[model samples]
Target: MVQKRKYAALFIGSALIVQGLTACSASNPNPNSTGTPVATGTAGDKAQTSTSGEKVTLRVMDWADSEKPFREKFIKDFEAKYPNIKIEYTLMSVDQFQNTITTAIKSGDAPDLYPIPGNMSLSMAVKGEWYQPLDPYIDDAFKNQFAEGAFVEGSTMLNGKIYSIPAMASVPSTLVFYNKQLFRDAGLDPENPPKTYTEFRQAAKKITEAGKGKAYGIIEGGKQIGRWKLAAMDWSALGGSGLNQQSPISLVTHDANYDGKEVLDVMNVFKGLKDDGSFHPKTMSISAPEARALFGEGQAGFILQGEWSIGVWKRDNPNLDFGVMAPPVPDAGQKGFLPRSSYSPWIGMSKTTKHPKEAALYLKEYFNKDYQSVLVKAGDRFSILKEVNESSSEIPQFKQYYDIAQKYSRLVPNPQIRNPELASVYGNYKDVQPGVGDILQGVVAGAIKEPNTALKQFSDIVDKSLDTAIAKAKSEGAKVDKNDFIFSNWSSDKNYSQQDYKSIQ
Candidate 1:
């Protein structure tokens, strides 16, 4: 079974407390714009105190579970070097991790550092007003070493301040992990994976017929609510760039923008799969691990997963014979809509930190070559540094995915969570639906009809959600600079396909 990581927060706590002025600056009229505090005091700050001392303890939490042998060893190695830093490790489910940290912050016991998503990073940076600014430490040498998107320098920058740094950077594109044995049984060439949507569907059909009673051609996830594999992966494969990446400010929250005839066609293909009964009924609720296990045991032909799957599979079954391929495109020569999956839980030090210099030193070490290489080797994670990719020992199967990412990958910009106030304008009708995945599952199962309408409704809500979020941010002192947020290079012209459900029916 696959092991999942949860929320990881970094906290350095000391018994000593230093009080100071807590007031919004005159330069900004917004009630929330408090100049990031410059912390004073060296004795209790995490940066100043060595963890080797019996009295000093440095609290570090990571979402990476025990299954990640590499991270475990890395932590042990770091602790061995910094004997004074008595690091405490805590494991929490992904669902509970964020809430746990938020509650700790409320109780004044938050960790000194923690991992945060892109949306969370922006939100906390603007709302918390606690992380220390590392500008003083970001010298020319440091700046020159990092890549263009390493810090997400453009997206996470707020009011001329940067709050977090990504340990690795890459846009995540979906990957197809198939059992070589199963492919051969189905009369397909395991070495030559499908290149287009038509070929993919044809392969799935043959695999299903070959599996007989014991296996399936494909098993899509159907649990949760409206957002399922059919919508996320299948639609993306059919060339649906629902959300434009050209603009840093415009996030895909609404269906009207990207949910025309093309999306419906994507849904139709998925519906056809359900009609053929090639998927498992429990696909929605059984979890990703279950799906992986099924494929590993030769009960399923193909599974769609992120980059980590390769590392995970190697850990579980060292001898499993499988091949990794890019998800199929709609055409033979054209590129598919590959969603950027390069994600790293980011680290940000609260501006309220007393030992800013010390924290920067740690950050520099964190992003150093030696440490990153170890993580990549053990964690099966891709690094942000271009040099790392050029020199990585990743297997050829995984390397192929990396090579493809250079040209076809796209990031989801201005995610909905980053700016909640603009929810309505951006088409966000409700808080992110935990059960959304299940809704998509229902469509795949024939339990729900009009899949396009359902998807559109969800999309519409997200679109308005962003519109409202941006307006509120502007009203609340956020600078509305169009050039910075807009993606002027993106084109939605002839290459895109349009669908009409009524005409098809």
Candidate 2:
């Protein structure tokens, strides 16, 4: 549900526009119930309560279509509590969000708060002065309500100052969502899903064969650049590939070996599916949402998506019986692990906003535990808070994915946590052309004949890109090195915690 966004910055040949703020503050603070969010303090750390009876409209923008239902009602309630403040919320499309936000900032028309675009890095956003530091509006008691490690330096907090708050759990990745009826029609046990690569391939083949042009083995949005790898990464990550779900660069090696055993093995499975005609006819042309719709319509036997489908399908097709499970491994045994990095920042306050207090208040109310519960029920994703997840048992399907993400999730080494200065080092690397996603898409689409050569070339490009990024960072006086990116002592089998970074040395 928390879609992976690439860091892409748009340049309009102008500096970040700035607007002068007329200093205003409110006195006193109080802790309130779930309906009424925590009150702010006069101290800069606490958000100043907006007491001016003047009417104000605060602008907000985000791509979380999954959270729209709760967010809309939350906004309406918030307006009821603060009659003078009206929220103009914009739910932007995931694909166009980055470009639109960047253009808005360039034009000095940015929303009150917006998530850092996929193509833009937090450091770059901060360095560009696109967001104002949030420490002045939020206090410790407010932050303490979040789960452990929610406010991470170099992520939510940079240089001891907070910039953004994580809105969703970071653990959920792609999973197998299969139609029970389709599995039964294929002569497969709808209760027992495939666990091994062979079994998965055979099941898909059987499903396709049984459909007789009525359906396919599995459906995917192949037209999108990242769709293929989004599902395939689960196979690679769970099959001892050390695949960093967020990026191609492995946390263990801090480099990529796309042509290595982990990736190649998974590629073979997808290739086999393609050769066997187990993919939907429109798989290569449809978008991910379209593929999900078709899957919901029983046009395919299975789909690889996030747990958000639990809530989505429940609302759209309450009678639809879909079983959820992890993706198949190379064999029955597991080889690799999934990285559960600390909470990643979700949205930040715009520097040019006129109503910082109102915007900060909205963010607080929107990301609280109350909203987190809504998140779980919506099946859009899990909450960042541990208590919210622990309290959720009624939603069994969503709970299943939560359990899966927790079982395999490990605390991987973070180069930025080890060296906060790596913020610049991180934002320096450029996206390699024909990336892992594109390469896999091309292979499955039958456009590429030599995956070996392409994978190796990609690995080489990653190495060069890492080297160039380090060199560029050094030139920029970041005080970073390639070794900072490497954690030779860290194992893929176990977690590398914050304390481990110190202990390893």
Candidate 3:
């Protein structure tokens, strides 16, 4: 996935010698009456000291929007503060960021900071000693700025140290966004949206019947490799916790009903939607961008999107009338659980970095409230601070999403990195596909044998995969227990009487 750099430049370094004076051939003799030249320090010393009159350049990399004007504005203000430091930003695509960052790390030329996705690979990040720990730099003052559970204990936390800081945290699971116009055209009430799964299905069905070839009730992304997205979404929306205290461990090697019922129940809903022809046929191959585009163009009615899609949708279709709401739960009595979705994008220092203090100063100052507010306005990312999120005035489009995120977000502890051997036991998107495809194809094809068997096989594969990964991690000296993967505890404003805040694991 490495894109070739079209332009390249090379520089050769060597010791510098003062040339003889030309023109007037004038030379100043030492005041001590000894003809001697000044001493020159080592190359390392030269690098350590910034030129007195020149600026020190700090390089930054990100996969998010590079052209967003807010970033440029932030840099201008940052430069004004540190007149001697120049910030250079490089942007890359998320798909290619890993390879790109790896290359930079190898050359010891990566930017001062960049975001890393929150999947299984992050586990390796800590294990491989690629990141610099922030414990020394982080005091109550620094930690207080971020919200609680913004950093998962064992997952993002490694070896009793916090190595990364999630840039813009979001509710990763439990919310679904729908189109207003489509709902209206289908004779469904736009203002009071669905609050239960039954209502959701009914609303989707109405849209399909009214739309004909124009629209679909819902779009299923799980049919393709995007099933992970579906799993995450359902895990939260359905209020299914991951491995945790109250929930305890569900041994994949021995238990039959550990993780199956919840996963299957979520899958069956989509299978029903697919069978009903409520989903677009093109969903299997559609990427996230494609889904966004389809929603923007008003081709779909209800979409399972989050705050991340808000900014893009507004930009793409400013005229479109849209509304945001929590993904409907099973009943009004049961408040919906919004799964914390994406891995909190982290800003980690290089373990091999020689300028730890300087880097900390940059992060502490640069990512402080002022600039972070700029990021919140420009991007759809939620702030990591409670004060900032609660007091937000700008970005009206994202207000609802931010509010729900602050209140109902939860997470699962299952790691999501890629490992070769475990891929067979757990299966990848390819394994998830046939089962989901069978459900979809069966719904459209009027066959149950394939979808049911495929789903059971798929679940077995996932269970086995988890078992393999756990064993592998143990062999590698990881201090992992079954409880580590469970999410028995949960916190919410409605669940508890305390007015401060609550967390659901």
> lDDT by residue for model 1 over 1-505, one digit each (tens)?
0111111111100100000000000010111211111222222233434423443344544343323454444446555554455445564432345567667666777666654421243444445554555566666566555655444322334445566555445434245778788789999999998887678778877888898868777764343121243244324433654433222122222333434554455556566666776675557565454566566677777776544455555556556788877666665344345433222225566544444544554555555555455434432455555575456435555566566554464443333223323222222122333222334566676787876666656556544544555576676665542232333333322221112111221
C-alpha RMSD in Å of predicted model 2 compared with the true structure? 7.3
Q: State each model's CA lDDT, in order.
A: 0.46, 0.66, 0.47
* Per-model tally of clashing residue pairs: 80, 10, 18
* Model 3: how far residue 286 lies from native, Å: 4.1
Best by TM-score: 2
* True-vs-predicted CA distance for residue 156, candidate 1, Å: 3.4
lDDT winner: 2
Error of 3 at 122 (Å): 3.9
Q: Candidate 1 lDDT (Cα, whole model)? A: 0.46
On a 0 to 1 TM-score scale, where does candidate 1 land against the true structure?
Answer: 0.72
